[model samples]
Target: MKKLYSNTLMQLIIALCTFSFVACQEYSIDSQPEGPLNIQIDAQDSYTALATSPSNVVFNISSNTPWTIESDAQWCVPTPSMSASSSLVSEIVVTMENNTGKQSRTAKLTIKAEGISNTKVVTITQASKEDLVVIPYDELVATEGEDITFTIASNKPWEIIPSTAFISNIDKKSGTGNEDAFEETITIKVPANAGARREGTITVKTEFMTYTFTITQNGVVIEQEEDPESTTISVGGTSTGGTVKIRANKEWKVEVPKEYQSWLKAEALSDTELKITTTVNNQLSTRVGHIILKTKEVVDGFEGITFDINQSPAFWFNGSSENRVIDEATGDVKIMAVAGNNVIANYAIKKGHLTFELADINLNGESCLHFNLWPNAGNANIKLWLRSNSDCDFRCAGGFGWGQKMFSLTTEELNAIRTIEFFVEDDPDNIGKLRVRLSINGEEIGNLVNQTNIYETDPSNNPGQVINLQFEGGLNYTEGDYYTVKSITYEPAE
Candidate 1:
């Protein structure tokens, strides 16, 4: 019976033990914690009246925070604060003051719900004021040989005027507080015998302004010439060519146009093209435009020589002796002259003519001669013949019709020496012709065409043009030195 009671009790004990173990395991488990309520605050940027912004100052907080800052403000002043929806909070302000003395302050902000706090330091500095300064403080200038004074019988209190001059000082004073400003005169007086221009200075300073005064006198030395002004004659445009007038008290230099440059090939105009004038004074000065045409080839020259229509050399003869004579060097080359008879330099002979005894010639494949004819006009026939020192003779002797005139002629042949005689059978008009020649060589095997030069019909080659002497030839030799003036003679060829 005892064993049976023990067994029943053991079973009851086993059941009670199992129920207790299950209850312990169930009670030990806990509920999941709410994910952190909100992020905590960390630190903030320092505040400044001089905060160069558009640049952000970041405050690192436990992430997942919705943060925002107050952005409304005036120049360098903070009126609003920064806030966050998270557990932590940060308050800050930007403030400005009198712009002088400066210091820093910090705010200790505690974050609720989160065991965190934030701090923002603010530096306060003095502010700039609008009521200050003296304009362009370079010293004032006073002319010499004169008396200058600064009258300051009235001015602000606590104002001190610094001086770099002898007479700059406190003369009288008035006014008080901010109603303060001064009025005083600094006098600069030149001695009766003051030398030339003199100088001095006055320095002044006040709470609101600072300045320096400059003084001077005339110089002692005398310079009595009026400076020359750069005068210009501007052509309105390429619009029209007309008169351009210039005005000046003194002399001047002006540039001229290209059209006038041809006629007025001059240098250093007394003035320039049209003229420089004074309307008020009616003064006409030698300093006005005086056009002068200068030769372009000043360094070289008008390369070729000039002659009269008649082509006479008499215009070139100027001496103190016989009016007419002969040159021993060029074989009786006539030297007769009566003021203006002229002749061309190089002349060429026509179809039939011969030149002889030409001197000073370099034998340039051609021949030339110079002579003068009687001024009166007339007509006649001239005869020509050829000769050679080498006995190489070729005669194309013929009579050439001509007018009473002196002129140069060119013929073909260096050794083609030609002698021409104008047949003055009856120079009823008392007229004559001067002759010159251009010559070139020839051969029996080759019939070379002789090149010749022609003249213009009218005598209008002056004001606008010149005689264009066209040269022609089979060989076309560039002009050399053979052409020379030898002599002149007359023969009648009816």
Candidate 2:
């Protein structure tokens, strides 16, 4: 009985040991350690940047898990707050705003990763506003042999470097900056330039940054002599005028006749030139005038130089008369009734088509046709047609206060006397083609037609074909809804 009890006790001890080992193995399988929480940051502990301008700080992060970033200051912001786990290194950017504060400031940035107990810290410091340099002007314009003064403010030492030889005698080449916003006055002398305008640059260097500015200098003027006999100036009937060369060494005075003084004017443009001007000469005959130029000294065997100015006459259809009879057969222009029973009258209101043939006028070159008309009441619809030698016809038809392809007029302008002009010339782009334009009251409106093939079909046969201008009143014209043609004029091509 004693041997059997000893064997039973040994078996019970072995079964208890086996059960404890199996329970330990099951606990180890259920609660295994998590993957390694490895993370690294590649950046410095501190950084410095400018205060006046925005600056950026870049760094790299390496991690097996996701990461995030945060900033303590409102001015300092990080681009990405959270990032996924990446095998390759990821870049992070921290942008700092411009610091307008009087003193320098600092910000703290924290970088953290998932499942990590500790975070990386970075400190960023920005300079103060007083630490930056300031330039008031970026460019300077100086005359020949002139001095230019400018100011520079900074709290550091600065230097100026001129890029060209013309810049000389700088008052201050170097200055020590001050903390009280001291402005340093810099004066530079520009030497005389006898030939042409010159340009150069002045580079300013400070402890914080570098800046560049431009310097422009004017050229000198030289005296010249011009012969007055060979210098002849002519102007159109209605033009501002032209210039004439004069001797620069003499003091000159111009004398205009009493009759021509109201229309002619003369002034000195420069020491070597004189500008002559004239008002509009609305007469039919060309006018001639002599401008007597009296100088301080005698020149070319005469006490006073005489310059003859000839102004071309303005073309008129009825010899400058507002009310004139229109001959149906012979004259500079022939008038004929075409559409309605209304006849052409002297300053008369008409409601029919009137064809005016430009007798013996050629349009192969540049020319202008001008006329005055009054739209009696605003209910008249007028059509003006221009035919060049029966080849092509250009038409402009519109009521008053409306826009047309040729021109546009206001209601007030149509009720009063308004001048209408048509200009015909060769097309600049298309060779052998013609271009026509329209104008109202001396202001050019727009082109009527361009690249028009005129006089091309029978150029040899129609060598001197006349231009036909026709006016047609609206078919719905009433008693008072009629337009009147006051005057007609033509300027032949020169």
Candidate 3:
């Protein structure tokens, strides 16, 4: 029985040992690195590709397992391209491409061994590439110094973190299109400062891209200085007139005529070559305004003129041959010219008197009277008479006759209230000497003067009103030889 038991135990033990060995072999086979294909690979962390050079990719394949790399995987270009080496552990090189004017990108790579695979893609960017990114104006044409508002319309699709930039404090806003342009503003000051030129740029970026713009500043340039001072002038004096020299700025416009305009000449040495000067040579009844000097768009030449007032002649004798006439301080008028402000004065006081022996004296109604005066301190004594022809008769018309009427001569001041009269009427029966009374308030001033032959032009026919003195000189003669004037002299009344 013991021997039989020993034989069975041995058989069991052997069978158990064989079973343990098979189990051990099966566990080892199950723990082994198993796959469709398994081979150790030398793939780096982010293999696949880089910006420029090829990224080496090694794939581990199982023994006798077939595998290949995708054709579209390149490391140096934008589009992916690839090439693979032997089985067991296939290796591939990838070249990536540069995208926009932005970053560089590499295609995702996958290694397949017997239908199972894994993939990894990488993108590399270029060195912040940027060109003349035009900064567009909102309005092509605009006014100076207006506000400009905008932002960077970037190139990429995704919203990007703006790149570092510099400009005249531009408020960045929303971008434009897919290839959106950067936004900014430039203000132009006008006239004086605006139209001047200025310069600058625009910049933008994402995780990958950067850009910039060529900046320039531009606007209109205006003037404001035209206020001028007014010219003042005084009457009874002189004034310099013409284009008032506008030292500060702006534009202007002068005429003086005859009267006191004697020797109407401006001094040659005067600095006011563009100005005009005139003098008042005589007196006038009305107030004369300023002496205006007319201006023109261009120069014509010198304009010279003069005027006359009532019969107060304005005589200028600078080079004249008169010894007694003296020049006034005003440098224009002459004193003691011809006895009556106009001629050569007769100073000797001659004794010879003129007598009129008229024939016939007729007036065509015009009474031209002549007078002799005695002036003493603004007071004057006067005698007047009708002038007649040489031959005493009753017919010719060549004479200044004033015998028909009578009037008074009185000064408003000194000679006022003095009554002087000569009473002598035409005699109907005589042709010889006629007696006339020349008296001043019951006193005889002188001999009652008479004329030879002179006719009277009715006072109603005369145009000029004469200041005649009723006080006659000597006695009135008869109508025969007509009343004759013995003399016209400056002798005092006796």
Candidate 4:
């Protein structure tokens, strides 16, 4: 019985040992030397890019199981095109096509490890690319001695070459850059052109393309002028007129007309030059005068030189403390008036046409131009007043008071430089009544009969005789009030 019991114990120990060896083999198989399936890559990837250039990014991955890289974006492509990775440490390259789009782009890339929970995502971003641009001028057609500029832009280094020396003065020649493009400016200066049209070209070269800029310049122009040989000479002062130099080979003599002898004088400076001097005309009318210059020794095919001279009309002033004549700083003629001042004229405007040009008629206060008329015989004296209102239309005194007629002229029309014409006629039917016609700037308004009847005569006697002309600045005028009369002329009406 003891031998049988010992044998049973040995059997139990053998069974326990066999079970332990099986358990060890299974543990060894489960704990094999393969690491977790994971991909090691940057969290975000970015690339600065230029137009027409490719961009790339690479990711390193280590995994026990197979791994693959994928992106749904069309512009993003994965390298190693076959399939997943076969090696433990493999590279997944992502390539972006040459950027043709004008804006930046973004994409997401996913890395998947098969049979493992290791998934990695990479956010990819790229900057927008700028195209090669030339600003302002591409082709220049300019005149001689003109300056032309060309602006160049590119992602890479650039160079500019001029075709000829005709274009010079280059401000800048080359530029250097990387992802972002830089601008370079070059200026072309053209020389003075003598005769014909000139042409040239500038070649701008960059990494991607080449630009050819062209230039053409016009020739010079020559012209000749014809006239009365000399410009009309205007004399301002009373004592001395300006001097004129003539290019002549011989001696010359100047002859002054008879009527102008009192004011005009000429002296020979040298054989070919003459200096003309004059005194103040003091007359009311501008002088239409000429001086003849003849070569003492006659030359072939040469008549003498004749110069036309114009002496400005003498300044008119009533000499009253209230009103005076003022020569403007700009050399314009003006009349200044205060209250109760009168500028009277010697010659009257009778039954004829009277024309006057006004530079400006701005009135700070109420005033009018006055005309006094006297008939031939047995007629009453006539008084006519001319005035303007805020609307720039003409107003005059009729039979009664201040506001009689408004000429219907807008303010703009009245302010502009204008000509005023007035005509007076003798009345045959009514002995005392006179007819008046008025026009402004060549447009005639209607006629007025018996306007004021200021001057009246016996039917048989001659009428429409003007006694005198005068200006009265009424009670409203101040110290600074002024007006300008450009010109005045009178003639018999047709």
Candidate 5:
């Protein structure tokens, strides 16, 4: 019976030990802590006003657990007395007593939260009484020879100092402070600037701080002679030049258009005169160019002066008596052709003559005749000739046989308004022989036609020779062919 009792007690002991171990294991696995402690603040540093006028800085706090706030300085007090724990977010207002001492003062605020090993700290700083002053403007612009006004607000005494002699006539240079910020009007007069623009500064000095106001004044104005003689000048066709005058207080420059720069040129003779020059006007049409004169400085009233230059044409004839020969008896000026829809000749009908009686001009040297002709559909036959007089026969004339040998034009050239030019000059190589060159639309074509002894020297072959430019068409070809002469001109040798 004794052995049975002892074995029963040992079995009971082992079962109790096993049950206690299992219960301990279950409790350790199910009851585990989560996450870490966190705290955040909106500001790490804050600023306050001077001691006489105290300012409040509000701090926003966020914490996962409950938190408390405390300040290290006696002069800085945090409101809502965070002696107890507050969860989530809390806004605490901190009132700071301004530092009356010479140096600025700072205080540290400590925020503590439960279960967090580290704490958050914010530093608050307060400005001293001597560091406070409010000036209205930092920089100002004053007109030439004018006065400028501005106000300065401060609670302390201040005195003004000008950097240069240009700044003068100050209304109030020094003033005493008051309990509240008092505004004082400051008026400064700037003398007129005769040279370049000037800049200076006005320094405001107090017991401890210094402030500055910059002043800028404009320079003198540019003046020019408003009522001059004239702005238009004329030049002759043989490259003769002219000049115009311009008087200004400042230096001036001329700007010419790019297209006319090749032929036109301008030079400044002095502070008042400008000379205009040009190359020879070879074409039969008048040419005009414009130029601008500008001063370096700002003008009082004028922006720029514009000048016009007119160049005369070398020789111009458009079915008018200006350069043509009119019949004395009938007073009739021969008409060659018209422009656009005015048809000069139609091959389907009878033959037509496009003739021009040029004035008795000496063509012994170099001469050129230019005209625009339009042949419809490229189906036409035309002939051009130049004689000294009407009595001269076709065989004795010096001209081109259009649509024939050495002067054949392409279909594209025939369909458009073609610019035909005839050049007659004494051959350089052969003195007596005349060199006749032809071109279409500024492009030279056909070999240079050389005619020897065809001028006044040979009277039998060429009679009544006076250099008359004429054209006769409609000798041969298709029925629907037609042509028109838009314009014609003669440029005699210079």
Candidate 6:
């Protein structure tokens, strides 16, 4: 019984000790925690305001420890009760004084916690309202001869003065004595820009500041004339021709058409004067041709000149120094004229074979002598163009017209005074068709057939219809280039 009592008491004691050990272990586990103190702020890092307006900052904080809010900026003030109690939520308020200065400013607020060594910052920005600014900003652009307006905004009275004489028409030069308000519309005008691009500035003077507004104006361009002046001349029938004068402001050149090249030429006496000479028309009636003169440089009122020439019968052309003669035996023609004055031929057509020789063949860029036979009405035409130092060709003007023998007359042949001949005869196979045969220095070329019309019985090739014989020097008209017509003859073809 003693052993049983002792064993039971010992078991009770062991149970009490196990209970105490378990309680001690539970107490030790409850004494320590895993989570740390958490702090949070609900507020933006920055704030903005106008210079004349005051601003406020508010912060909502959730913290597990005591915290205090303060401001380092002199312009920033915080409430006296700015601390957050431990384990509680609090709202902090800070005030920013009105920014009346002339520039932008910034302020900062700091939030500090008892347990946390770290801090949070909030920034406040303010703008100044004491500036003078113009609408549409600091620059203004306008075209030549344009008008513009501007408005000034300032807190004090201001004056606007233009920096350039080109700017004019100021409606108002000074402000209306109002403060902190935009001024009335100030109008200004720009004159015609006959010069280059221009830029200037207008100074806006205020009590405390100055504003500059730039003005940029476009430039103007002078226009060129399109049509040139013109004149006319009439030639007589005698073998001797007359002279006509051309006037200009500068060095000028003449372009003669091919049809009149048989008897007409031009001479540039001075920079301003051009003398034209014609060969007395040996044919029975009147003929016509053209001359175009152009200046090398642009002149204010002078661009170009056109001449209308009318030549009379051979006997009527007497009294002029230029002369030509036809040999009755072999039907050859000889012509003479001043060097550059009259180098082309002008004649009325007769029923005969025609022969001519090239005294010289000198050409520059795009320069040539033109030859064509057609009624002045400008139809059923044929063309033969001779380019100096280059090639020659023959082609009918209208469609169905034939072209042949490109470069048939070489420079050597032309410079050697080669004779070019043409004959019109009735086509035996085709009735009403005239066959025109061409040759250079006696060498036969193309034999073309003309089916359009026959020569009229009237003294003129076509009565009431003017025929043009042109010999030009330039690509368009005539430049300072010429080809000499050494001699020309016509013989009645049997």
- What lDDT tens digits, residue by residue, belong to model 6 across residues 1-494? 99999999999999977865674364332111125765677779988866655666676776667777777678777674455346555666777677676566777777787768888887877655566777632343444476777777665567888898876567788873444464567778777654434678888887657878688875421111221223566666543544444443345667787766778876666554556677655443455667766666554444455667766544222223344444444323333321222223344443457776665544444445555555543344555676645667776544324535566445455545467776666756667655667777788766776533345422243422122334443345334444444445555554
Residue 26, candidate 3: Cα error in Å is: 30
Q: What is residue 360's positional error in candidate 6, in angstroms?
A: 3.6
TM-score of each: 0.22, 0.33, 0.25, 0.32, 0.31, 0.29
- For all candidates in order, the CA lDDT equals 0.30, 0.55, 0.31, 0.57, 0.53, 0.58
**Candidate 1 lDDT over residue span 1-494, tens digit each:** 99999999999989967865564355432111235444433444343322122222334343233434333223344333434443233443344333221222223222223232442333333222312222322343332334545543223232334343433433432223232323344444433322323455555454444456554433332211231222222221111233443222223333334443422222333333333222110111011222322222231221211111111121133333343334544334332222222222122222233323333333333322223221112211122222122122211111223322222223334334433232112223322322333333221211212211111121132111111111122222324433333532111231
| Clash statistics: count for each candidate | 62, 0, 65, 2, 4, 39
Tens digits of lDDT, candidate 4, 119-201: 67677776555556776355544444677777776765677787887775577777764445556676766766544346777
Query: Candidate 2, after superposition: displacement of residue 265 in Å?
Result: 13
TM-score of 5: 0.31
Which has the higher lDDT value, candidate number 2 or candidate number 3?
A: 2
Q: Candidate 4: what lDDT? A: 0.57
lDDT of 3 by residue, 1-494 (tens): 99999999999999977865674364332112233444333444444233333344333232234444454434333222221332322234444343334343434444454444544333333322322233444342232344544344444432222222223444433343243334333332212112223344444544445555444433221111232223332223222232222221112132344443552432222222234343432321112333433332222232321111122222222223442222232222222212122121122111122111221222211122233322212221234443222111111011222222343332221112233344333333445322233443455434432322222332233221112212122433322221111111222121
Candidate 6 minimal-lDDT segment of 10 residues: 220-229
- For residues 89-125, what per-residue lDDT tens digits would candidate 2 score against the true structure? 5678999888876567899999888788899999999
Residue 21, candidate 1: Cα error in Å is 39
Q: Tell me model 5's lDDT, rounded to 2 decimals.
A: 0.53
lDDT of 6: 0.58
Regions of model 4 farther than 4 Å from truth: 1-289, 293-316, 320-332, 340-343, 369-414, 426-434, 443-446, 450-474
Q: What is the lDDT of residue 467 in candidate 2?
A: 24
Q: Rank the candidates by TM-score, best first.
A: 2, 4, 5, 6, 3, 1
User: What's the C-alpha lDDT at position 296 in model 6?
Assistant: 60
